[model samples]
Target: MKKIIIGTLSAMILFSGCSNFLKEDPTDFVAPVNYYKTEKEVFSALAGVYDILGNRAAYGRYLFFEMDMSDQCYMALSSTGQDIALYNYDIGDQKLVDTWSILYQGINRANMLLERIDQSDISETLRDNYKGEALFLRAYYYFLLTSNWGSVPLRLQSTKTPGEVDMKPAKLKDIYAQIIVDMTSAADLVGDVTAYKNAGRVSKSTVWGILARVNLKMAGAPLRDKSRYAEAKKWAEKVINLGYHTLNPDYTQVFKNHAQKVYDTKESIWEVEFSYMSGSQYEEGNVGSINGIGTSNKLVGYSYGAQKIMKPYYDSFGVGDLRRDWNINDYYYENEPATGRIVYAGNAAAIFYNRSASKWRREYEITPQKSVNTTTINFPLLRYADVLLMFAEADNMSPEGRSSQAEWCVNQVRQRGFGNLLPGAVPTANVDLPTGLDVVDFQEAIQKERSFELGFEGLRRHDLIRWGIFLQTMQGLKSYKASAAADYQYGFRTAENIKPRDTLFAVPRSEMVVNKLMEQNSGW
Candidate 1:
């Protein structure tokens, strides 16, 4: 909040000031050589770090739900927003540039805080934990960067002077190694995961979840090797055995926008914080209510009322899958502005061709977008289902590889939807699952399930790339541009014409030109 408004740029002066959430405008005035000498000031600075994690630019929209563009789901788009992501991202376009900037800005702010904290004298317990969190955050952002950009400059300390920022990019391999280290250390310092909030507060599970992901990514294609898979499985299992998390009884329980923040759900291990308060006086929206079916209009802005589900994925659900029935709805209403009457609507059925995505539907006021307390950024990082699958994936990756464990993992996830998917467990007499499936087949099945299970949670893209299916699954959406131009307001080109450099984004042109030591990622 408060930038250390130091005019002399000297350290060690203990100044006094009120602890308000200060705007950190860099281009501000000069201050006398006084400094923050109290513990309250330190706590305020720590809150600023958590606030950064909750910020809309960083995790609110982009991290929560924006990236679900594979054949499994679609977003109804026309000019302004949703359409562009669906079409442009199919071939990996400029959105990657936007992602790079947002993530780095978040990283830089967190680093600045960590630097400030290191320079201050705070309680050993709180200070060490906070420091660990800052490290985890930096590593978190870097993992997001390398996952998308391949190689990026790793900035640790806050650059006080202009010249201090002259830095070169680090190799992707090196970036990942550091990510593993930070998270591994973070897991050590963090306390027990007694509840989701405790985990939400950046505890052991959060770090372990991240480590599992980092390890899994390293062991997958593009960086292909299975060395880290067992480690990945181990970390995931550690989080699982903590006994604090479980899946929501119904698939929809964990996602209720206005529902009380219950920490009992088995599926959710970590979720980002967003609070709902009236007017712009506070941040956070009742995401469920905002997207509720009753609110024909919205508090912040109408999300264009899109829970667009693609036909192939809709059809992919087995008849008995509980997720299918629980996850979607078919109605939205609009207020007749002039007459003050209400109107209900569904997709142009012929075009959608299958059940549309139901995850976004709920009831509330509509027509004129309403403004009220809303919580739009409630994002989840881990859930129990993932742990089950992770355990299965790890078991499959073990030396001598147990195929049964992989089968159980896939079945646990499936049983929730289809019910009793044990050995010889089939949804219906006609629905045939392959007999005695092996590890590779089960691995792919889990990947597909994770895609659908965690779709639109800002995770599907990375998962697809790890599965080596990014190009394959997304390719279908390119053809959609031709058929959906008027609707989505965007079109696409053939995959052959698309360049591979698009896979790893350009290090925002600004970053590259400013930092002479920074070289662009290869093929960028």
Candidate 2:
């Protein structure tokens, strides 16, 4: 694979490079005038925008760590404990600061690219594709910002100095409006999924998938705009009707393919690319290291066992659900270093009560360097199964409960989960969708299906928040974890710690200190 080199620009960057610009009264870098003159430069600048997705502060670390805030997983005792505060909704300023800075850095890169793309001599099709990507990425960063911080300053122009650009947070509705416009325009500008040489770049299908998700969030809690349900369903159905994607028959293959860097364009609409060859450890994907099961003594790798599947979520799978075994590892083998022998090791009664989220296993990583903390795994940002589930959800949200299209969309996902089961061979209770279910029941079914289908993919919390059950579900999990017979209560928190204000993370105190125009989220 060709390595993408993310270069520096004349901007108030939060990440590495641009040291000369950072120093007062110092000068060394070329201005944007000299750059962005060629098609190669345009592509390079866009690569920089994509680079942020793999940064440790964004998807590489904090974003996935946010999953700990939900009931799906918990920070293990052996882990760094950086995310433990989030479990109790008591996040510190550093994480918020890093995430906020990195996302804006991405937005700034997109802004810089969008500002300069048209100046290049590239063909109209090429220019529009690049612009579409930049627009989609900008919208994506804004979506993350607004989703986590509620109202965030919308930075459309590139900044030349840190702490100089001050803007107030935009309203959530306004943010969504812009996201809709950008993604809608992106859909028209980009080509089909197959047109892209790789799944790392956004395509027409990718835009539709995200539009569906954005519309769903708009329709749900925090917005509760029922008017957006039809829009949500419409976009989701558009993706489904596109017929450009399908579910991978074996659910485990979806992740295994990612770990091995085997791109399955049919199921994965878009993925954030990561390479160990990037020369920076932080640039390499850390999902497997953090979420993979087994200790150094038990496995050939250096997994931190950071995120453990909570008992309740692990037990939620039905009797014949193949996804349960594929997702949660029941046991591991302890390797005797001296003898070079392996022994079956099951969890002892009270010591280790949690199962590892085995979806992204370190064992499947292609490199022979098992001790490396990072791997060349591409994280799937959007998948066809998610689109199908979103279709079911949005369709059920409408007056008509579980429409024929909705049922078929959902059933396709469920049947895929059964792996090799024949059409009629799947157990009646396992994959069958009951008829004539009410909207409430159908919605509940979709939620459960999503949990089962999308577990440990860094999506459960967002789903819970949008469904308006984040606090309620956390409270219930707390009680359940507390009552369970274990050496340590995993993911249990005191009731007082969780509040409505926690729905949005606290704007980093550092940000509030630097940006005078910024207002902290309520109850922070």
Best by lDDT: 2
Candidate 1 residues lying further than 4 Å off, grouped into runs, are: 1-39, 64-68, 78-98, 116-122, 195-199, 257-260, 285-295, 298-302, 334-357, 360-377, 419-435, 477-499, 521-524
C-alpha TM-scores of all predictions = 0.78, 0.89
Tens digit per residue, CA lDDT, model 2, 318-374: 777788877877656455453232332654434334567778876677753544567
Q: For model 1, how does the per-residue alpha-carbon lDDT over 256-330 read when each residue is reduced to its tens digit?
A: 531344454346666665543333424453344322333334432334434355545555667766565445444
Q: What is the RMSD, in Å, between candidate 1 and the native fold over all Cα?
A: 6.4
Could you tell me which residue pairs clash in candidate 2? none
The residue ranges of model 2 lying beyond 4 angstroms of the native Cα positions read 1-28, 77-92, 161-163, 278-282, 297-299, 336-352, 420-430, 494-496
RMSD of each: 6.4, 5.4
User: lDDT per model, in order?
Assistant: 0.55, 0.73
Model 2 TM-score is 0.89
